[model samples]
Target: MPSLATTETLIASSGRKSFRVVFEGFLHLMLLACAVVSIITTVGIVLVLLIESLQFFRDVSVWEFLTGTKWSPLLKPQHFGILPLFCGTFLVAAGSALVAIPIGLGTAIFLSEYASPIVRDIVKPLLEVLAGIPSVVFGYLAVVFVSPIIKSLFASADLFNAANACIVVGFMILPTIVSLSEDVLRSVPRSLREAAYALGATKLDVTIGVVVPAAMSGIMASFLLAIARAVGETMAVTLAAGATPRLTLNPLESIQTMTAYIVQVSQGDTPAGTLEYRTIFAVGLTLFIFTLLLNVIAQWILSRVREKYE
Candidate 1:
């Protein structure tokens, strides 16, 4: 018994509701698909690395891989010790951290707390430009530019040394740490700084004591990510660091990182199913595991800091 106009209104309302439901469901399905895509891709990579590494372990024992002091898998009498690669990786990573953390953190603090709008605008774009440059370019720069300077400064340093690799890798990771850390520091509530200032604290004290402490979780997270990046760097280190795998703490000496060695082996004409080819997978798995632990630790620290703040 409803009027025609009233019936038409009811139909329109029902149609709109139905359309909205369908549209919302479609959006949700798209989001779910995006999420699953990453998980599936990660699973696929892990499976391939795991399976190939298993084949490698059939020929070489895990203990030998973990504790071996030498890593000449391609040599006739193959020595599969991974410790030398680990040492070189750690040495370069440590040196890069030395350079990146301090300089990057200082840059972040200046941008977030001290820089004027004009200065921030100028410096930020410059930093981004530096970051956008290709890693291969950095490697070339390290070889042609940084290596000579390092050799001059440290007379004993080799042209292709761990020191040069560390210096270039440090530059490579600086923007990541600085950009993320600046965001974290800037996101610290202004009220915290004001309160410290109200208590007669200096600008330096307010920044270092209040703002930096509040943003510790995010800053620490950035450092960890930069370290992981340094660890995974292949091209820069491969070109800069010498192809020699040695267990030495001296930055002046030539050495090869795990990633560099992997690159070296892959560049060869080793056939598939050969020991040389399988070595790359084993090295990849080892590097993956090492980087995974660093990420887990970073997450744990970040979570703890977040809990405290909350």
Candidate 2:
């Protein structure tokens, strides 16, 4: 009963609405597919690690692997204790944390609270450029440059040592800490700053007392993630930290991390399905578990922070 023009308009509107609904459904399906792919990939990796690690543990008892201080799996008498690797890994991680946390946090605070926009824009990108450099390049840099400098300062330092690796890995993780912590610091409410200012608080006092506490959750999350990254690092650690798997705390001594051992075994020299080859998966699984725990903790902290802020 409507006029011809009115009927055509109605039809066009209905068609457009139908098209929008279909398009939205397609987008949702695409997103779901992407999520499923990621889940499947993670499951696949875990399954592979578990299967291979089971084979490894069949020969090397979990008790020995967890508590043993020696880690010479390929050498004569094949000691399979993983504690030395743990020590080496944590030595680099702790040293890197010491080097990175103060400097990275200070840089983030400066960028977020005080730097002019132009200085921030220029400096942040340059800092992030450090992140983009290849890990192998960092390894080479530690060997070729950092080691010599350390040796010059401390003649007792090994050519390949935990200290050299720690310095390089700290630089490697600096951008992550700076970027994430800066974002968190900037996200602190302007109202909070204003309130502190109203009470006669200086800018420094407001930042240290108010903004930092507000952003602590996110800052801690960044620190955990950076240390996790340091734990899982391979080439830089392997090349700079040497192949000696020893249970010593001296950063100047040559030592091997878990990831480094995996690398050493994963080279084409190790035959397929052998005990040496299986050690790779065992080490990989250990590294994976530790990194996963760190990530889980970071996520938990972030979630709590979000709930508080929201």
The TM-scores, one per candidate, come to 0.94, 0.93
Q: What lDDT does the true structure give each of the candidates?
A: 0.92, 0.93
By lDDT, the best candidate is 2
Name the weakest run of 10 consecutive residues (lDDT summed) in model 2. 301-310
Residues 34-143 of candidate 2 have per-residue lDDT tens digits of: 99999999999999999999998999899999999888888898999989998999999999999999999999999999999999999999998989999999999999
Q: How accurate locally is residue 134 in candidate 1, as Cα lDDT from 0 to 100? A: 90
Query: Each candidate: how many clashes?
Result: 1, 0
lDDT for model 1, please: 0.92
For residues 56-175, what per-residue lDDT tens digits would candidate 1 score against the true structure? 999899999999898898787889999999999999999999999999999999999999999999998899999999999999999999999988899988889999899999999999
Pairs in steric clash, model 2 = none
lDDT of 2 at 40: 100
